[model samples]
Target: MVHFMSFLIAFSLIAVSGKASSGFLYPQFYDHSCPRAQAMVKSVVAKAVAKETRMAASLLRLLFHDCFVKGCDASLLLDSSGTITSEKRSNPNRNSARGFEVLDGIKSALEKECPQTVSCADILALAARDSTVLTGGPSWEVPLGRRDSRSASLSGSNNNIPPPNSTFQTLLTKFKLQGLDVVDLVALSGSHTIGDSRCTSFRQRLYNQSGNGQPDNTLDQSYAAQLRPRCPRSGGDQNLFVLDFVSPTKFDNAYYKNILASKGLLNSDQVLLTKNKASMELVNLYFFGGQLSTWPTT
Candidate 1:
């Protein structure tokens, strides 16, 4: 990294201590331990995203999959071993969650800069933040100093990460379990603005949404028609569709607008508008005032 890319992150979490503390994460944990750590991560992520714009969303997804199970300990990054079963094989992550090689590149750089000083958990967090900003999203200071899990939990991964077909209640319940509220759910769902979903992930919405041989009425008929060609009833499970049809590669509030227009690609997404009022208001808040980035940090 000949030229360091500096991003001043004024967002910092309170430091905690003691074994009983709720959190021990700190945004500036690596300031002295590895001064170049964040910059190194940004450099790699910028290059990776440059080669493939979608890589930004993929990297961000890795963080979500990891944190949903075991609280961002990087257990999702582990490989199956003598006594450990990798979370990669979990239903939510199997053949999905990607960007491990990008993390490996980041960890390798951090190790070279300060051997044993950086943790995989921190790397995942930083990489996710960098990926978001690279895709024209807001940049936030991520908490660091977390450790990687010794063992991966396949069952936890499957049960934790909300599926694309989850109802509004299921999605909110999952977020509540994580100490997040409805606003968090709607705001986080906005991340779909930059990602792609496999045909299988949302094929149910295209057809047979309620097992009556009808497509999800919540989805715009035209969008469903566009999806049906590539994603048939039983095949082409791997076909990719931009989650947000309006601005697929940009990280913004278009996802909320899609939900409003009934063009939401996934069942879980449309539910934000149809199933709940608070979330719907948040969606409108973002779509109408999306340019302000008014998402509250609760």
Candidate 2:
């Protein structure tokens, strides 16, 4: 599982933080201007994760959502102004998106070191890599030099991000629209190994998953029962449950294991096993051990 996660995580990062040329981005982009730039990001992220381990996953998720809509451009950070509508107001990010304060700290420190030398988009990438390492996941060399977008995309955020209740095919199509493949989808979804999902995110699985008054059969009955009290059929929407109950604070393959055991918390997760043959196979590959021809390196 560890071996596979190392590969998946690298793919997750590389595939997400992708815009690099024309503008010319690289790992060494900050070498001369602010040599301590990456370290500052790591330090801020380390402290945040230490204070709240879930911050690691939150940072990572923030990176993914930001990059998906605007190609790692930090448009996700924008607030509504004259004509700009903040992505934060979108359905996908509403109450779920977080770690902005930690990001603000990193940005503030970087400005002190060298004003505007590091971009928020690059900070997102570096913090995500740092968060992964802090949470027992692999590291990747993040390409820097991504410029923050001046605009936010509310419609894009609402339409692009795959919702928690997305069917397997819907998830794949959304990923594909972002230039990601089946492999990237599976790899990135493995990030569910850490973090939490709000009751509102997965409440449908607990009751009336298919429009009928019944829980999702793929979700283990016992697990649903445990979730029902705090995550009733209605309300209690903000309550959070660990995505991977086995190692909630660690970035590992336990998420895939939970799916294998029919304990996946969200419909999107459980559908990987119950709805798609290829996705199910990938889940099994990630859960059990597997061989890789070549691993991604820094």
Candidate 3:
């Protein structure tokens, strides 16, 4: 089994052995080692996204979850074996996270082209950017040279990745712990513009949020009414709803627009507007930014 120690060793070697420029990742990390690495990853990611549009969102979320747990080291990709526990079973993952098969396919293709030359960590980062682009989202140059971890962290996965029910301040603190600020939180939350959330993820808001039996007051009553029949108080845990009701598959700022209108899907999402002034301003900025390019780059 791949262990966390192996990841540390790999990262240490790169940092100390001068394999990467002063230990920092760059877009050109694979230029000499495997010239076609990025192209291969993008091709595989494009094919996966074509098969199922939601796969793009799944892949993007997968990278986010991975980065949160272990600094984008691909610890999330390790499978369970012996004493090593897989992060897949963590609270934020389990039935919620996906797109592993897509990663496997990309890894297989890369191995054939250049055996062990590309790390799964870098594959995830590249696939995430490609997935975003394939889904009509913004494109950015991803820094490469991340090494795959040999171990997974179930505790870190659970503790680090914020849940759908997290309060606005809790979510902000969680992002801050990872060295991200309000701008990053709001910008990254724009990913919700393209994905689906399970019924269980938001059902608490529909039936009894705050233990009050009444639905969350922040949720638009009409929208909540529309959701209850399909989501229900029980069963349908796996039933899916678009995170962004409008432009569900398009990677735009519709998520912020929805939140501004009290139509955001999850408690965590709606709280961005309801619970904090800074977050509300970010939401407004993205809602009116009109395009991904216009949103804050910081």
Candidate 4:
């Protein structure tokens, strides 16, 4: 019995040590690595760019689009074959056919390049970065090797994503559920700097601001004017414009600065500045021409 106990104790120590060194154990997405991780990520991202360019002009609009009224649900990824395995209900914002076409092309290329060595989840992450930069956002280093989710849950998609009108707490909860920190949440929301939100999406934020939840009164006059035509009183396009006016096709920190100066379009975007103290600081950092600051780099 004494000998058996000693062996058990030794085995437990090894197991704990292994777990500790692996790191990013929770939320699961962070726990990934590919055979040629960085190279694979780069190659696939380049493919997403090519695919986007090949599609119709309207298709590019769909690819970089976000689900503000519905939250950034990636359900737009599910096809008829994918829907059955998706873990969440499909969001209408995901109806962009071209986005998935690009994704499929990337997947096919990766298969030939590495043969089941990469995960679609990782491809999505890198492709999104490519898409954002292509649309005029800052290109940060993308962490590679995310695992493919075995199943899709439409229910999870609806409950997990944040609404255009979600409160600070709700937004934090969504990020946490996805294994992102509050800082990451603030930064990720910056993606909105280049995209547009439909009038219907921001109508409540504009007219009955309170019911819509987040209310910011500092946007420029002309900005509202440009949006008004599309987002009328009765409800029209809710697609609000992003702050990266110079080049909506490139990813950068311009959106962060916009928030610092009260130029964020979405109520949720402005709320990051007004609602959270730390979030505001981050916005200021970027707004004032600060350096890029998210991990996994991109």
lDDT per model, in order? Answer: 0.78, 0.86, 0.80, 0.50
Off by over 4 Å in 4: 1-89, 96-98, 132-145, 209-221, 238-240, 289-298
lDDT, candidate 3, residue 285?
Answer: 61
Could you give candidate 4's per-residue lDDT for residues 1-298 as a string of tens digits? 2222223222322222112112232223333533454455556556546655322222323322322212223333554463364422345344322456565777777677667766554455456545544544334444333344433455655565676677778888876654556666665565554444556655665556554543336565566666666676685453445445544544456666666666566667778878877767666654564444542211
Better of 1 and 4 by TM-score: 1
Candidates by lDDT, descending order: 2, 3, 1, 4
Clashes of each: 0, 0, 5, 39
Measured with C-alpha atoms, the lDDT of residue 153 in candidate 3 is 89
User: What is candidate 4's CA lDDT for residue 277?
Assistant: 75
lDDT assessment of candidate 3: 0.80
lDDT per residue for candidate 3 within 22-97, as digits (tens), equals 2578889899989999999999898888899999999988888888886788888988999789999998999888
Better of 2 and 4 by TM-score: 2
Minimum summed lDDT over a 10-residue window in model 2 is located at 289-298
Off by over 4 Å in 1: 1-23, 290-298
Error of 1 at 65 (Å): 1.0
lDDT of 3 at 146: 69
lDDT of 1 by residue, 201-290 (tens): 999887775689876788889888888999988879888999988989987777777889999988899998898877776667767653
lDDT of 4 at 49: 60
Q: How much is 186 displaced in model 3, in angstroms?
A: 1.0
